[model samples]
Target: MHDRGRGHERRPVTQHVVVRWKAGLPRGRDEPWFLMTDLERPARRISEPYARRMSIEELFRDAKTRRNGFALRAVRLKKADRIDRLLPIVTLAYILLVGHVRLARRTWTPGRWCSNNRPNECSDFTIGPALLDQARFKPAAALAAIRKATEEVGEEWG
Candidate 1:
């Protein structure tokens, strides 16, 4: 593969990375293969950074796929570039809704969530007022009143 740096310069390469895999349990001979061939200096350092990006990717996947949140079906973008542009906005909206729920509720589980793989499920299935108000609200306007109070506090703080 060609190595491209942040400065938009290409590097020549004549090196190979050798990796070995060994079979477990039943016992088998070790297998070795070259992962890549390169002579660029930056890639060696970038490997760790690239692996660290998986956490953010997994979060988006968990929110979109596992939690059945951030549905893109309602969006009508056609081009790949448009889809890429919309993904961040969709993710931000999902995060905002989650933040809203967490802040409104006293107890919020960070990682505990149900995996809803079905695409056609309603949004109510993933989130509802019951999620924030496990006990029935004392007054019909309690949620609305809390939201108004939060907005006033936010404005005052700003």
Candidate 2:
């Protein structure tokens, strides 16, 4: 490709593939997702990574949101060292919350959600709301879950 900004320098042509996907139940409204990637993979293969990205995106969203999860944006840490110290605590807490929610999900009865509005399958994005809902009624349980997750991690490490 010709780079206009670089005084007409010639560059290698990069290719992008757009995967058009309809994401929803057969009875639900069609949610179209256009996944664009430069990775040289089949259409079906490219979509898998994009699907996995939704979880990481959700984690970021939860970390940043003021009303939902730990609003890390509200923190006043100015130094890189302080921010580094804080990240592991926040990340560990987030992971434990997710682990707790996953365990909680197994016991949850059909159509008996505490915070979910749609009554649909819960994804990682939805876990923040569900965790908040449970924390309202059971603070001890949340603490216990965190301890359990810590112990599990310790076991794996040791």
Among these predictions, the greatest TM-score belongs to: 2
Model 1 scores a TM of: 0.29
Write candidate 2's Cα lDDT for 66-141 as tens digits. Answer: 8666898999999999999999998766666665575565556524543433444555445646555554435467
What C-alpha lDDT values do all the predictions have? Answer: 0.48, 0.63
TM-score of 2: 0.57
What RMSD, rounded to one decimal, does every model reach? 12.5, 6.8
Candidate 1 residue runs with Cα over 4 Å from true position: 1-12, 18-34, 37-46, 56-67, 74-91, 95-158
- The local distance difference test score of model 2 is 0.63
TM-scores of the candidates are 0.29, 0.57
C-alpha lDDT of candidate 1 relative to the true structure: 0.48
